[model samples]
Target: MNLETFTLFNFWSSPLLATTAEAESSSLILAGVLLSLAVIYLASKAGGELCARINLPPVLGELVFGVMVGVSVLHLLMFAEAGEDGSHSLIMNLLQATSPMGSTTFSHVFEAQSEVLSVLAEIGVVVLLFEIGLESDLKELLKVGIQSTVVAVIGVITPFVLGTTGLMLLFGTPAIPAIFAGAALTATSIGITAKVLAEMQRLNTREGQIIVGAAVIDDVLGIIVLAVVAGLARDGQVVVSDVVYLVISAAAFFIGAIWIGRLLNPLFVQLVNHMRTRGQVLLSALFFALILSYISATIHLEAILGAFAAGLVLAETEKREELQRQVAPVADVLMPVFFVIVGARTDISVLNPFVPENREGLIMASFLIVVAIVGKVLTGLGVFGQPGINRLAIGVGMVPRGEVGLVFAAIGAATGALSDALNAAIIVMVILTTFLAPPLLRWAFSLSEESATTDPASLSGNISEPVLVESERLQSELVKPEIQ
Candidate 1:
């Protein structure tokens, strides 16, 4: 070695300090992270398979598995997510049992490891919204026309107003948390509904078309609501002007980005066309999403919105199908992490009714569950001039909140906007609604099928056969693992 290098090395590695403590700490953190990931993957896959076998959305499996390994159960994974203390991580407990880590150093490692996993979960969600954006075909709504728009608007307004007002008046929930939960109620898990319709051979029916179109619109609207609520939730309190500004800003940002992105599509396509490297389209799309995520974060909106807008923009290009194909593997790798983390962070023990203190939360959860169902069920009444339309089926189709609801729950929890009882309440609503919708939708259709055939005029809405033929190609694809 050179004289200077030898002297410096000797100084740091004398008999007093032959070992690199920083390197050792880094190794411990890495080891802990790797072990946690292995557990998550195993649990997620097992849970996913079980859920899929039962004809349920596999994403449900991920959340259930997460709960099994999380704060309320096995404790294999833990985080500071939504007020959870990183120091309570059972992964850290295992690491300490296996290794000779000092208590102070162990605390540092656990906190650092938790931070890393939390960031990974954030990235996981961003990728999710990106993929969801790719799947959303706004043109499909063209065939369903104003009726679907009516359903979407009514679906959003009804639940939001009822849930928010009820929480404020009945439960005395703070405005921000109440609003966040209410906005969450506005989401429709179209994926679950889509699968049910396809299985029943009713995917192209008038009610199915309206449900699919409305669900897509609400998902779009739900993403916007998430952005605004997240922004308000972060500030710790909501103000009138701030709320108005966030609403306007989020709407403008999405519409403006899509508009500008369309104008620049040819240029984007040209850039991709000129590239000869591996993953040209996938990499470009991600680059665009990440850049937009950064811009959204800078402007006080959630980064997921930017990622979503990126997906929306790129989806308009000629490479949509290929881009979608390429995006799945990446999502498969990351999306489960986000779901698992949300489930792990959720402490459902608060929902137990036996405990005196827990009774209030349980009561609140019951209230939320009621509102979640009735609010969406009311949406069916919004459709005008379609007497043959199965309004009950349309309402039932919008019932499941699925992953989109969890997105709100996760964000609210992470921001500390939701109390433990409220978080548990939201989770209960999500799980039950997701489970209830598919079967309920089938029942709605079954009850209406005979009438549909008897009333020749009833089977037809403003929908044309040709438009529905094209829309079928879009509706038949159910919500995938991430968003359903």
Candidate 2:
């Protein structure tokens, strides 16, 4: 429908929707934002619930719903300008029949809206990483120690090699795109694995501990790889000193933040406890997270790193329970927005097998999925010397690329390092991995349990009681204290 046809709706006819006039533009933008939020929220919620019903991750449903409403499907949120023929673009239609305002005005309006959504999505990711950090115990991670480090190192290397090699061999992709593809594969989304483990009540298990620990270590390594790749993409050549600088900066940021956070958290908690206002602790925790996130961004690292560090610090405080309780609702609201936006960014046309031109993308996506899965699975083998550990389960748990992979792909696309075909391929690979991992993990865990009970001798190794006990103890410590 044209802009005029769209503006005929009583909703747009309201004076609040006027945008062509200079005086009314701000109000029009605000109204449009509110309307967009409403649509995104309702659509995301419905999609999440639908996915849950079918035993898939709610994220998959949210993403699919985003596509359904986005440019690829309904074209409800397209951001293009009107063609030379003067037909209204979707954004123009939403602007209440604003006249053909040329590229500059269209860019301004589009950017304003897109920027808001992007910021919200970024915040959602920050909250997510924060929660993961909060749930993690540094002490337990230490205990998992060398084993997890081994698994994580292998996890990163194997996927990267496989991804790069496969892309080059299968599609004869260029070096830069191959590197981006490899980098994308290296990310292991702990959120998906954590959710699956939590659901199956295996979160406190030995295997779970190793997976979580390895995933955490994996995150650190993945971020470093991302920095290097981003630098290479921008400069068109890798400078050793630049790479070294990023490594040092990222490492210092994490270690320094954690060290500083630990030292300051007690004082911060004490100050909050003495505050007369209710929820002061929660507010303080959030402020700290936001501050750290800003600092991380300022240092050219991912903001989520600082947010995660903030969470680790806060997790050590006396008010962990209260902070978690207060933060849960906020995280719940923002997290879905990230996943939906991720879906919305996806262009489904590249995945249309019926389109002859898109066949390469389809082929690349298929091979990428295989590479993503096998790469992570090999990490399970790194869990050596520990008998009775479910290696398959560990690998399967780490399978879902989830938001982490999407973040890498998004960076590549934004930097013009990845083509449309490659981006679509990465998105499809991410979606399939995210969707497939949970059920596979569930089956793996079930098999582990059955083996333990019915055919203990058939298992490769015995479950380590000491490790399991420590894991349980750590889990107990991580749990929020009950309010009286």
Candidate 3:
């Protein structure tokens, strides 16, 4: 339906109309929705099981299952019977429902699927971030210290070089675009790595500490780089003063937020502790997150960074353990929906070969994907000190580019620094990174199977122990503490 004529209830159109022909179409559409959800649910569970069977992370399975249920493979399977002849068969009927949005055969079914996917995916992201926030411990991350700095530096440098250089070579002389592309690849999604380590029982070890430290550093540095690149893309030249201020300002926000939280931590906890209902605590904490997020956005930084920082500050409070625990289940349900939506938003047909006109966009997308992967892989070398440090794990961890990358790409597209093809390419790259990491991590962790089940060798050299400690902290923070 056209945007102008659409109403929210239009989404609730009856799948089964009164006329026989229309009723069949409606029935098929309803059946299709149920089928899709059932498949996704089963696939996700199967994927998780497959991961355990193969000694890989369950998330890898989840992603693969998503893709299978996605338009890419599943839809293709559903449509396969439409070959050669304009035949009449059940397979052909199935194909109609699975076709892209414009297919006359099953437009309603496709639209409903798309809408469901979007809502779920958005919910997934929010919950994922919230859960990550819930798991974080301010005191522990602070204690991570110099190692985190070094890891962050190495992580930022490697990807910046690889991403920019690769892009510049492929698309000659628009240095600023190249820089933005590279900057987009540099941020690390610690949640993925931490989850993998937790699964492998390595989170408490020294290696886990380094990973956590490096991830925090990478995140902070990544934003600063994005800010600078964003500024350059908006204006033809790099603004030195603006860049300096952005960096300094971001640093100050983090430092200041944590400092204030430390001071207010006790009082906030005491207030929440006295509340009769637990919702009061959750509402108050969420309020803190929102205010921080708003202030950060005002300073031209991503609100998520503020939210994350706020969570860290709260991590030091006496109620830190209780607060995290209470918030976790809410996050768990919401987060998966977000991921599903991410997959649904992706219009795979946009990268079509049949549409000769859009081929340029496809080629551009292919190039960006290459740069995105290589750039992050190069960042793997950032894991220093321990010879045993899983460089592959670090590299894979840096792979997925989520909100941070999208913001940069969107800005680039909006400012005309990037053409339509290039913008699409960046988005494709982000999706690829998000999709690829879980499997890669599972494989990397599996490679060290012998070591995973063993005891820690030493503090700095031990990857397993640190991962365990981190997970435990996450559990304590997210799962409510036992009441007296």
Candidate 4:
């Protein structure tokens, strides 16, 4: 039949089909998508309200909102217990009709949702990290001194030992498994610490600098440990050759990435300098991030490390603030998708299975949680230069295991090292860390600030005081207002 005849014939045959087809039409789906967007936006606002009331980060609220719309929760909320299995519910019918045929398969649906969530979550993570990098001041970090390095080292060692011992004792897994699990717990989510410091107005303080510096070190240390763990897992034994290869390869990759970034940054800025339009500068920064990410991934490192390195390089440029401003909004909208997806992948159903039947899982999860928190907290003591420094606060600041921990566990799962229970435990750790860090860090910083205020000696006055003098001299010489 011709187009007009087809429409006319089917027009009234099934009102439901007709309506669905109409809804399936671009206009209808557009409306539905728009509605979804509205719901998500409202959800975000609701999250903000909950955050305000509970003294949690509003972003956490946004995360919870996403979970509500996720397949697990509210998606299931639409059905009565009886109708759930009958497949007669409106929402289910609509979802089935809208969902691709093959997508109805549980695995396929999961994979599709997973890919989408990963992308969104990554966007959130990238932007979040970018913001952290943007706010970082190298001079501030330097002023914090050997103390920060010491703190990160101590932090790394404590967690590594505790996690390894716990895994070995509790699970009696292979040596490699124990090593991988321990390595997973070693990295501190410095992003958490940085956010906390900023919230407490301590970002510019000496303690803040030490925490930030230690965080960077923690990243580097985490990667090194990850590489070692990965080598052991893959080789089944700590091969001397493999160890040397990984160490050399990682060392070379980082040094080379930095050298390359140094060279590329100037070239990129020059390209920006020659661009005809203002947006080109922003484009150049983005292009650099993409390139760096690709290069890092090519060498078997995290793309994030590359992205971070790119940001660090651009951080040195005069347009750092402008670059950050351009990147922030895009990152903000997309990054939380990563966190929400992380939550979604958790499969809380797994927890139900193990809870009463397998107390071992709960025991293991609790042990890991303690190791995770204690390892990073103890790292704070590494802030050694100043006597009576609030090392406890700094350590607590570094406690969350949001992204990096996930990366480690994911790699283990991918490689067949981590079993389902172990993987689930890791997910619990991630969720717990993400949930706990904001409030704990806030309290830690508040205590530090209170102490600093009460006693001038408690303030990071020694280093900061000198830096202010240098800043003034540079400001006077390097900047001049117009004589308008």
| Candidate that would win on TM-score | 2
lDDT of 4 at 332: 57
lDDT tens per residue, model 3, 75-173 = 421312112121222333564646432345455544444455444544454345444555665556666556567667866787678767876786673
**What is the descending lDDT order?**
1, 2, 4, 3
After superposition, which runs of candidate 4 have C-alpha atoms over 4 Å from their true positions?
1-43, 75-93, 98-110, 142-148, 170-176, 190-204, 253-267, 349-354, 387-389, 411-423, 456-484
* Model 2, span 139-169: residue lDDT tens: 6656777888898899999989998988888
Error of 4 at 294 (Å): 1.7
Q: Order the candidates by TM-score, highest first.
A: 2, 4, 1, 3
Best by lDDT: 1
Q: How well does each candidate superpose onto the true structure, as a TM-score?
A: 0.73, 0.79, 0.67, 0.74
What tens-digit string does per-residue lDDT give for candidate 1 at 1-484?
9999999988867855425656777888999889888888888899889977886656667777888998889988977535554556778877777877877678778877888888888898788778766765545444676888899999999999999999999988899999989998998866556645754667657787788778766866786677678878887544667557766776687678878888988998999999999999999999999988998787667687788678777878899999989998998888778777766766667667787867766787788889999999999999888766789999999998876787788888899989977887888788778767766876787788777666657556535676888788666665453465
- What tens digits encode model 4's per-residue C-alpha lDDT throughout 1-484? 8999889877767797666654444343343334443445666667757886887766567656655654446552121211233142233345456654332342333333334435555656655655565566655555775777788788788888888887888678666767777888887766555655664567767677777777766777787788677867886655566556655765576567767777777777787888898688677787777786777667665566666666666788888988878887776566545544444333344456446634555567788889889888877755555886777778887788766787788898888888666777776777677668877877776786687687756466776888999999988776665422
User: Which ranges in model 2 have alpha carbons more than 4 Å from their true place?
Assistant: 1-23, 77-107, 190-209, 230-236, 402-424, 452-484
Of the pair 2 and 3, which is ahead by TM-score? 2
Question: RMSD in Å for candidate 1, one decimal?
Answer: 10.7
Q: What is the lDDT of residue 102 in candidate 3?
A: 30
Better of 2 and 3 by lDDT: 2
The worst-scoring run of ten residues by lDDT in candidate 4 lies at 77-86
Instruction: Provide the lDDT at 351 for model 3.
Output: 61
